[model samples]
Target: MLTVIMASRNGAGWLKETLDAFAALHPPEGGWKLVVVDNGSTDRTSAVVRGFQQRLPLTALHQARPGKNAALNLALEEAEGDLVVFTDDDVLPDPDWLLQLRQAAADFPDTGVFGGRIDPCWPRPPARWITDLVPLGLVYSLTVEREDGPCDPQWIWGPNMMVRSALLEGGHRFDEEVGPDGTMAYRMGSETTFTKELAAQGARCRHVARARVRHMIRPFQMKRSWILGRAFRAGRGYWEPEPERVAILGVPRHILREVGEAAGRWAVARLRGNARERFRAAWDLNFWRGVLHEAWINRARPKRRADASRPGARDRTALSAGPD
Candidate 1:
């Protein structure tokens, strides 16, 4: 049996579409179990899940403590399937998602973790340059066609990943301190840590292109402020362990470089067409904002050596020092 776990927070708008996609993936012999973890959504997210409960074999778990990891852990505790699949509420899986995953796992019995592609479902048509400027998770659509073999482990994107239950029971789970939680501190990297730990434990992890999902890219994300904010936060998460002197000097240095590059592009675009340049400027600015916000928060609450020994210390440090 396959258990699909989705950790959601105020994702009412897109929950139905995701659930519908899952329902479409149901096997004719025996359908998969769907578990939705409602992470303290103020909107009608719970109600939306309730509507789908009758049509599908769904279970809703409520985690009042806010955080994507917290909600994921809650679902993990209750997951009863031999295989566990994780995805986000905003992502719509392909019709053959489960079928492809099952086939991939069967082909490689030793595989512990398998991830698919995620293409952005942009609200409006975006300039081609925007794809280059912003990271669109992994380019699974293009990479999936290669021959099946062991590849170097890259960072994991949350939208589309599947892991076996034995892997979690053997003591691997999502890091609870980070991930998007309504603040500028959008925490990430838990997926990266989880996959690395799986590899370290001698478990095989692979990626199959057949299993794919369309990530709904919101209009708000296209804005210049949001793009820069995301970029800065990502930078802060990457470089959190350095001394204050290093961080203080490094923050503006990177931001200035990005700003200069964006300005140069914008200047060239003035003579040519401005569409690509404008989008690049927007992404760069937003990324810088996220980085600066992360730096400011880090400066405000410097991490003590004692705090570094906690359960989620690395992630906490990353969230505090930078964007996720």
Candidate 2:
């Protein structure tokens, strides 16, 4: 059986729609079960899950701890399937989503990570400022447009992806330091953290293009400030300090210089009265600023440990220097 997991927090309205889509799903060959973890919701989120109990093979869990990773960790205790699929509470999946993911796993028996296609259902057509400045994949968790086959596991984001149960059961857990925590600002890319570690252990990854879902893009995300804030958070998530790079107080010296330069660019863009250039410059400024701050915060943890999965995998920068 494939056990699908979701974490919800005060998103009852959206969850209702997502569950309705779930109700229409075509069950996979091994059958499927749904587990919705209530991540400290004040709304009727629990009631919503209960409403779907009779419609799907559903299990409801409550994790009062705020973060999304924490809630997912709680649900891991109930995982009992070949694949532990992860998704958000604000998505409408295709009818054959489970069947498609199951087929991908069956077709690629060795691949431990599977990514599904995520299309955005925007609230409305976005303005040019957004279209020109914001990236769908960065903020919205949309995957490669329509490509299939082998791809980088990092591209497989949290909105829709599946992993083999053995890894989690083997004691792998999500890093609570990262991922959503019901805050105005937080790091993204929880699943990518786990998947990369599993990949380091020599587990192959794949893109299951047929398994698709439409991630609902709320109106709040359209605001420039929110997008800029996300850019900073994205950089924070992307941070991986090169051990050999010169540093002081854990932050690379080069980063300080780059941030200063970005500030100069930001000033110049503002002077030029170019909306696009100003936004681009501001985006880079925010990204580098985030990287600089994270670098300083991770100062003591200078380098990553060698990949323990293989005898001699190449050393590379890691997302969270903290343990999984």
Candidate 3:
């Protein structure tokens, strides 16, 4: 059996359609259940879920916390299946989504983690800039377009991922501090962190092409400001490079080198008058700026304990929203 879980906050508008998609899913060999966690939604999210109870194997739970991870933790308590799948409220799954996921699980029983493809469903025709940024993962999350096979777990997005229940049973949970906080404060790598930790514990991930979902893209996400802001948050989430990786004369020099490289890219783009190149350069500059911005923010704060001073430790303590 499988259990699908997702968290929502004031997402009633999208919840109804997603529930309709869930109701249309063809049952797997052992069936599946849906667990929707209401993360302090002020809208009609609960009523929407209740309306679906008679049509689907749906269970509604509430987490007063403000973070996506916190709500996911609440759903984990109610999830009851060997294979637990995670998705978002804004996604519409394929009719055979659960069937495909179950088939993959059966075929690759040894692989404990799985990710399916996520294609974009734009509300309107995307702007050229928006389309360009899609490959950068700033426009929409879960952009994996890999062939069916084993892959690095980090590419998996939270919106279309499944993992063995044993991981959660062993006390694994999403980092509360690193994901969406029920608002526009977009943080990156919430699922990536958990996947990296899973890989560290000797688990590999499989790519399931058939178990696909269509991620809804709002028109606002296509704007330059939104993309830039998303890039900034991504920079903060992915800023904690290994000391050995960025050890060229320490943090200061390494950041300088990156900034200089980005400036060169911008210069070349401007000289060539290539719109795509210019946008890419701008994205790189924003990401680097976000990295530096977060660094300054962290530097201003009080230092953490010796153990928490290690690489990636600060990200969890300062950026994460849940208990460490």
Score every model by TM-score: 0.77, 0.91, 0.84
- Compose the digit string of candidate 1's lDDT tens values, residues 197-243: 67667777677777878877678766656655655555444434335
TM-score, cand. 3 vs. native: 0.84
Instruction: List the global CA lDDT of all models.
Output: 0.65, 0.79, 0.74
Write candidate 3's Cα lDDT for 155-263 as tens digits: 6777789999987788989878767886654556677778768877889888898889998766776678777677666666646544334333334456657777987
Name the best candidate (by TM-score).
2
Looking at candidate 2, the ten consecutive residues that score lowest on lDDT are: 315-324
RMSD of each candidate relative to the true structure: 5.5, 3.8, 4.9
Error of 1 at 117 (Å): 1.9
Question: How well is each residue in 184-263 modelled by candidate 2, as lDDT tens digits?
Answer: 55765567677777887777888888899999988988888988787677667666756778876667788888799999
Q: Please identify model 2 stretches exceeding 4 Å from their true place.
A: 300-324
True-vs-predicted CA distance for residue 92, candidate 1, Å:
1.7
